[model samples]
Target: MTTPSERAARGREARKRVPRSSHGRWIPSAQRPDPLVVLEREAQDRLPELVPLRYGRMAVSAFAFLRGSAAVMAADLAAQRHTGLTVQLCGDAHLLNFGVYASPERTLLFDVNDFDETLPGPFEWDVKRLAASVAVAAFQNGSTKAKAHRAALVATESYRTTMRSLAKLGELDVWYQRIAADDLLPLVRGDERARVADRIARARRRTSLQAFNKLTETDASGARRIVEDPPLLERIPDIDRVTLGKIFSDYRSSLPEERRLLLDRYRYVDAARKVVGVGSVGTRCFVLLLEGRDDGDPLMLQIKEAGRSVLEPYLPATAYDHQGRRVVCGQRLTQAASDIFLGWMTGPEQRHFYWRQLRDMKGSAEVETMSPDTLRTYARLCGRALARAHARSGDRIAIAGYLGTSDVFDRAVADFSLAYAGQNADDYAALGAAIAAGMVTAAPGA
Candidate 1:
């Protein structure tokens, strides 16, 4: 194996190919595709009736637009050169995607929770997406441009510093690194600590039992079932329910022998087609309710369709034949710890699907409600989580060397984030205009 110095030298050499400072530039090319067209094309295979809801949700705000337009940003990032440091990317690394979730060990951990568009590619791409999100979120929350830029800077600086620290560790030490939820409280200042603790408390309460109480109720016959909330949550048809029931077995087969036995103890109860996430509005997603031990015990699993990663068009082809497996594998590789129920299967018409707990202590920040200081603190924490994630799959020493002992990369990414936030705002307006002109459809407030 090469020494740490050799790896560091290699990373420094990459600067010659794509200077870290060059990341600040964000001149939209005249050839850039229309944002609406890009979104529509990317979502062509989705359920047609629900497409309008996606557009409506995305129209909520400029930050909402950014959240839903991962493909749009992917295309833009592809237009520019990138550092060749490869890592399993959380293709949509916006601030909200990094949150608290329960690991298999029942330990709460802070890490990247979403992986809908995961794939291996250049490391800086994820950093740019994160920085851009921090800036957009800060601006939407009413922060000044300078404050927004500083918030974005905090994210990248935290990432750089975290990566540098991880680089000094041994192999197993780096592999075992994780940011525990309990450890987060001490990091926050006076008033923020209580708020952070409350969020964690809320997440712990957001279990299958909480979902069982909120989502299900007794019918006249005394059978409990999921309540329909129109366009957002609807009970699946009996036939569709049967199809998912069969697919559940296939998903179970993907798990380890022990997990399969653990799964067999629960009997399938009920299911619903549920809408989730800003960008994932129109995807084929369903929730399966299962009962174990007694009627009081419940487990909620989500089976979501998996399509090609948005980055696939620009980066290398994924090695997995099944897209669902790609998502499962990527999630397993990047997360410090993964959900116990994680698995993948092929559904009808050969569509790909991955299953995981619908709500295993999952909690995300309410970015719009955060004060500027709180946002800055949260942004830095997310940055640290992301760096730990990347170090698991990439060359930490090289990444640390590329970042160096200065804040140059952080400042450059912050500048890019601010510049791209302007591009995102213009695109958001264009989307609204399309809806008004009858070129696009939207079901506002859905």
Candidate 2:
């Protein structure tokens, strides 16, 4: 293993290769592919009927467009030079992606919750994505351009400061780092504390029993079954039951021996097809309902289709051949603690899927309606959470050294965020234009 001095030197060397100030640049290249074409390609593997819904969601606003178009940004980031320092990226680290969730230990923690696009790549790519999303959100929420830039800067600055702090810690301590729920409110204001507390309470109430009550009902025969909300949540037909058994068996086998025993305690009650996420609408997603010792005990697990990462084409080939395993591995490495049921399996059509609890106190902030102060504070929270995650998978010493004790990197990223926010607006309008021109059909409000 290299000494800390070498790692620090390595980080500084990367600066000479790619100047920190160069990060602020964002002029779309002449050869840049059309954003619509990129979205079209992404939709190819998705459910055809839901394609329009994805487009509709992306057309909602510039920030929504930024959330759904990770591939477009991946391609754009690929075109730019970056610090060679790399880490497991939260492939789509938008404002909404950071949230509060329950750890296996039953402690509430704030962390990066989405991992559909997770992959190893240059560290700055995730930072840029996070910063750009903040800028887009600020604009959408009616913040002035200057206020937006300040919010974006706060995010990058928090990231830089957090990474630097982590670099001074011991290896095990850094690995064990997590931003607990208690750390959140102090970052926000006094009156807003109630709103923040209310969100947490709501998240705590989002349990399997709550989902059971809301999503299922007893039939004439007294058997409980999932209610069908056609297109969004549909019952698995009789013909697919046998295939479902095979899928369950495979998923169970993928778990650890102890987890396999834990799996054995629960009997599968029902399963249903479900649509989820703005960008992942068309993917094959399913909610599995299981019963424990009695009628009072319930567990909900979500199995979402995992495809090749959007970052895959831009970065070097990922080591894992299975996309589901790639996502699971990235999450395991980057998260402070992972869900007990997290596993991957191959289904009937050979599509890869990863499993996790449907709801374990999972909740996100209301970004669209946030005041400028709340948004900036929230931006800093996301930035710090993201840095904690990056430090887990990358060399904090090198990353911190490259970042140095200056705001140069932070300010440069903030500038890039504003410029890219403009580009995102243009792309958002382009999608709206395409829908108007009948180039693509959009389902009304999905």
Please list the Cα RMSD from the true structure of every candidate, rounded to 1 decimal place: 1.4, 1.0
lDDT of 1 by residue, 326-347 (tens): 9999999999999989999998
Report the lDDT of model 1 for residue 226. Answer: 88
Kindly give the stretch of ten consecutive residues in candidate 2 with the minimal lDDT sum: 236-245
The TM-score, computed over Cα atoms with residue i paired to residue i, of candidate 2 is: 0.98
After superposition, the stretches of candidate 1 with alpha carbons farther than 4 Å from their true spots are 240-245
Best by TM-score: 2
Tens digits of lDDT, candidate 2, 1-446: 99988998999899998888999999999999999999999999999988888888888889888989999999999999889899999999999999998898888899999999999999999999999999999999999999999999999999999999999999899999998886787877787988999898899899889999999998899988999997889998653668867987899887889999998999888889998989898999999889999878999999999999999998899999988899999999998888889999998899999999999988999999999999999999999999999999999999998999999999999999999999999999999999999999998676
Clashes (backbone N, CA, C under 3 Å), per candidate, total: 0, 0
Supply candidate 2's per-residue lDDT for 48: 96
Give the TM-scores of the predictions, in the order they appear.
0.97, 0.98
lDDT of 2 at 64: 84
